[model samples]
Target: MSTPRNVQQLFDLTGRVALVTGGSRGLGLQMAMALGEAGAKVVISSRKAADLEQAVMTLQDAGIDARWVAADASKPEDINRMVDETMERLGHIDILVNNAGATWGAAAEEYPLEAWDKVMNLNVRGYFLLSQAVAQRSMIPRKQGRIINVASIAGLGGNHPMMRTIAYNTSKGAVINFTRALACEWGHKGIRVNAIAPGFFPSKMTAGTLAAVGEEQMAAHAPLLRLGDDEDLKGATLLFASEAGKHITGQILAVDGGVSAVTGG
Candidate 1:
């Protein structure tokens, strides 16, 4: 057998390519930055060109090799086009981060069908299509890949009484199982699938939730007694995207500062 690689070498992502969806902001951009910082060339995608442009500049300012594509993850045509464009530009994708998602607030008994469909389509179905496209177009042939799906601690169980995001919570639960099932099917193809179940982090998507639930109250739910900062996800993202996690698959890692452990949440 060959000697083991050193920690730094194992974590290095040089020469690899990554595609991150919903990457213009929030948790998605955080993960993109982590991958690029570790030496992978990264392509960030979202529906709006303006947002992608700004995000690309931010990544570039940090001295990362970054590019952007504009596409709505919920649309199949867009998913195909995004993957094709990424492949055309970078030649291959070694990592795919399924981070685009949507959430709707409503009491379960009063939820609108349109709202439910919107959340599920973007959060769950989008992940499936994009992963399938990337795998078929790149990873399966190469026989090696890393897929990091951004799930949520909400998937662990129900949310606080003040929260009312039935569709979002359900979609996340699906994502958790989707990660596991895909890992099982793709392991033989040398693809490792895992998920990062983040708790409450302040972002555009969570702004309303934070206000509704009260940031301090939300933080108090976690043993760490703090909401996640910009840097909280970097280490976990790097671990899953790098060779350091080569043997890990079908796992759901909670980056929630012990919230899930304490509250199943």
Candidate 2:
């Protein structure tokens, strides 16, 4: 493929097809909007059909060619079905966003084994399963693809004691390396893999933590002195998904408002 000479061409996602897991709401929805607005046909997935219906409607309202499938990222059968459905409906997948995940909060000493396994299964294993399926079925044969995994700033190191999410933190730490390792293995085949380690973002997963640690206190840790706004991730997501990041691979880009930089991420 030849390179596009203009800036708009570099950032454009025209004619691409993207699949985003957990795309019904929160950061997943935000990134889906970015991809759709840039002209990619978008497919979003979540465990709930009702949520998927609502999300599809929202995207349609915004004039995006978006739709959804109901699949549990944690299950292998469900993951395969998602890929099958995407192929049947969209024909091919050019970009895959592994954004589906779970978080568990409990003191390290009291964390339940079941909860730990659940978080690990969904956050780490689930990502690998889905990414592998997409690559094998779509990217590898075509020799072109982009995979974006959503890690967390907590993965860079230990979190505040108040966070108390050992399993979630550990899984994200693994995700950082998973991005690097996959990029190394797939780059030769024209696949680019990378991760975004976001700082505190307002979502259902973080609501409890934010409530306990207040928004103002959370913002104070970052030099920017503010929590992530709705549009904060759009630019970074576009960079990775579009030709703007064609040379980049196997890197973890933190969109944490300088919190990771100050905290040694």
Candidate 3:
């Protein structure tokens, strides 16, 4: 391997292409922008075309080469179509961010079976299917790729008194291990797989839960005593997407402001 002469070169992603699921907003968009700003051509996906369009504009406004496709990441056919479209439009994909996810909050007894299935299908199954599609269609064939799964600090444990998202938590636990197993299997093909398990972040997904529990109280649980913001994910995304993390894989990074380390009282 050629050693990078400068620090910036390690994070440089010129000529690379990245696809971020759920990149229409929130954490997905944050990571997408990170890859884009670092010189990658980025394609974002979501279920809504309007959201995707707006996000594309937002990225372009920020001077990033970005585009989008509308598809439900949970559906197998949609996943396949999105992959085909991405490859056709971008020629090849160097990075795939499985950031698309869904969450549900309810007392375990009252939690409908439907909600369980919804969360599991989208959060866990969706990630696997997309990653598999990308690997088979492009990454494996090219013998080069990066897969960054968006896990959560919630996956590491189950002690959040403020939230009752059982399905989401379980799915994320699967994601953490999924990243590890895939990395070990795909390393021989030059495909890197890793995960970023974030803490409480300001987003539509967390709005309801934060409202019920109060954002301040939630933030205080973290050692940093704060919720996540737009830029928190950028550096980590770049690290995994660029040459900076070429030697790193099968790892789960917690961007949770130290929340994962503390247990419930």
Can you rank all candidates by TM-score, best first?
1, 2, 3
For model 2, the stretches where C-alpha displacement exceeds 4 angstroms are 1-4
lDDT string, candidate 3, 15-47, tens digits: 999999999999999999999999999999999
Ranking by lDDT: 2, 1, 3
Q: How well is each residue in 188-231 modelled by candidate 1, as lDDT tens digits? A: 99999999999999999899889988999989878999999889
Off by over 4 Å in 3: 1-3
Write candidate 2's Cα lDDT for 129-246 as tens digits. 9999999999999999999999999999898878999999999999999999999999999999999999998899999999999999999999999889789999989999999999
In model 1, what are the clashing residue pairs, if there are any? none
Alpha carbon deviation, residue 228, candidate 2 (Å): 0.7
lDDT of the structure predicted as candidate 3: 0.93
